[model samples]
Target: MVTRIEWLDAGLELLATEGAPAITIERLTDQLGVTKGSYYHHFGSAGGFKAALMEYFEAQFTTRLIDTIDAENAKPRAKLEHLLRLVLADPDNAALEIAVRAWALQDPDVRATQERVDAARTAYLKELCRGVGADVDPDRYAQLLYLILIGAEQVLPPIGRAELREIYNLTLRLID
Candidate 1:
């Protein structure tokens, strides 16, 4: 039997590949090679499924990732570097991330979730800045970092690894 997580994973894949409008019960069921009964069993309706998807996205991308970074024993600089590298290397979530951003432009629910995510992400970056003993205002640095990450994701023709590294290195130097 397909679990709720499986259903959500399929939803995420569909969202990444086909955008927000493709997140219908019928389409997801077809994508998973399942029936509508299974979809309703877990999510009850299309709205339910979409709500779950947003929750899952926030938990996985923002909450869990921040928790992992905070829990790490590495030095602040190292922690930030690791996160930068991870973000730069990530390809699977790029499309989904952009799709969600687009969804936020029209949907208040999505916009609220995106706001929460942005706040959490920026706050974490500020924590890292403080941890590294940076004299600059942590909030400002956090904003800049968050902007770079989000902007890099949105830019047409994704930024190359070399450019990513250069940006990361420059940010690290400024922080240090």
Candidate 2:
């Protein structure tokens, strides 16, 4: 049987595969091998489904990371390293982020949600910087770090796992 989580998961896969423009009740129903009734029962409308997808994205990537970092018993540097490793390990997650960013350029609601996610991510990174006794301006450092991470996904060749782990370690050292 279809569930809310299943719908969101399917939406994410559809978003990654076809971009936001492909998100429709009919399309989702086809993707899930279900009917319109299931979609309507879960989401009320296509707009509601999109809204839910945005919320799910924010919760999965931003809120969960922040919670993990805040609750980590490791040292600040270790926590930062762990965060970097977790993010860099997931290439598919990076692709979804890029897809959402592309969609945001056209949709106001999506742009708003993307803005919130960026702000939250930067704030979390800044907090991590402070925790690590960074002498640099935490806010600025956070922006630079986040920009590097996002920019790498956009412009650089895909990094190997070892290379990514090295970079993560080096970044933590630089911040510390």
Top model number, TM-score: 1
Q: For residues 1-176, could you state the per-residue lDDT of candidate 2 as single tens digits?
A: 79999999999988988898888888888889998898889889878998999999999989998797778788777877778877876778877888999999999999999999999998888877777776777778778779877776676575555776676667656665
Cα lDDT tens digits, model 1, 55-95, are 99999888877777778899987888877777666677778
Q: Which ten residues in a row have the lowest lDDT in candidate 2?
A: 156-165
Kindly state the number of residue pairs that clash in model 2: 0
TM-score of each: 0.93, 0.92
Cα RMSD, model 2: 1.7
Whole-structure CA lDDT of model 2: 0.83
**lDDT per model vs. reference:** 0.83, 0.83
